[model samples]
Target: MFIQFLKENRYVSMLLTLLRFYLGWQWLTAGWGKISSGKFDASGFMYGAVKNMSGEHPAVQPWWGNFLKEVALPYVDFFNVIVPWGEFLVGLGLILGIFTSFSILMGLTMNFAYMFSGTTSTNPLMVLLGMFILVAGINAGKIGLDRWTIPFLRRLLFKKTEKEQFPQSA
Candidate 1:
């Protein structure tokens, strides 16, 4: 039934596009603020975060945490420096619509981390937003740089694919 609605309403596509762009812009702006504030600090913070998260969820702790603890934490400064930049890049990617799907997934990954860390309330909005972005797929690129960049991006990322054209609905 919902599928029929999705098929019938052309505005559903527009809603999805607007939602993705707005959410992406919001995320990018927030992350950019953090980066520009010059107070970015994730050293022991992220390590502690990752450890606490793993300890809290014993059943789901990936083996990679051990590697993160051993190899990654040793260079805490590097992680601290990069985390905000990574956030900014992912946010920029989404906001700019460069890699809409991948950026949405990255945003979801970060949101999931926050959600799992006993911060579900604040994360819910973004999490739902991520879900919508994912369900909407690549059709959410009309009002962003992705519309112009995706052609070049497709050549670089999906050079062998013939299905990299823009959506008909747009």
Candidate 2:
């Protein structure tokens, strides 16, 4: 069944590979641009934006936004410092087809977060992108290092099912 699925849906794989690669590359490039801007500072930008909006009308009040001001502000500030680097890493991982699923998962997490905190126009697009990443399952493991390592790691880290142990022996 799995082999048939792959053989029949190979075009789907190609489409997803293209989509994931371009999106990932775009994200990484954006992060690189931010880092190279010299004036770019995550903490300063996020905190300044938050401080500027503390009592003003916010587009949305994602639960964490309030916590951001109350308890997470400092961490938010700290995150700002690292976010560009994180974006770059995630993007690089996805584009290189290494840890493809993991990278998409991370990207989806960020997109979902954005979807909740912004105006409807931007939010829906991000939400759609996240859904695409999830549904496409574009791991591309066979074409990359993840193929060589992740299966072994999974076996070491997780319990094998009876089916996995027995396979045709069942």
RMSD of each: 7.4, 5.6
Candidate 2 C-alpha lDDT tens digits along 40-144: 554443444345433566654635555555655566656665667777887888677677777777777766654444424443554465455555453443445
Candidate 1 residue pairs in clash (backbone atoms < 3 Å): none
Candidate 1 residues lying further than 4 Å off, grouped into runs, are 1-9, 47-68, 152-170
Predicted structure with the largest TM-score when compared to the true one: 2
lDDT of 1 at 77: 76
Q: Supply the TM-score for candidate 1.
A: 0.66
> Quick one: RMSD of model 1?
7.4
lDDT by residue for model 1 (1-170), tens:
66454434567767866777677676777678878998866555546545654554542245545655666678867866666676777778776667777888888887776554334554688888777767665566544666677777767876654344644465
Worst 10 residues of 1 by lDDT: 56-65
Spell out the clash pairs found in candidate 2.
none
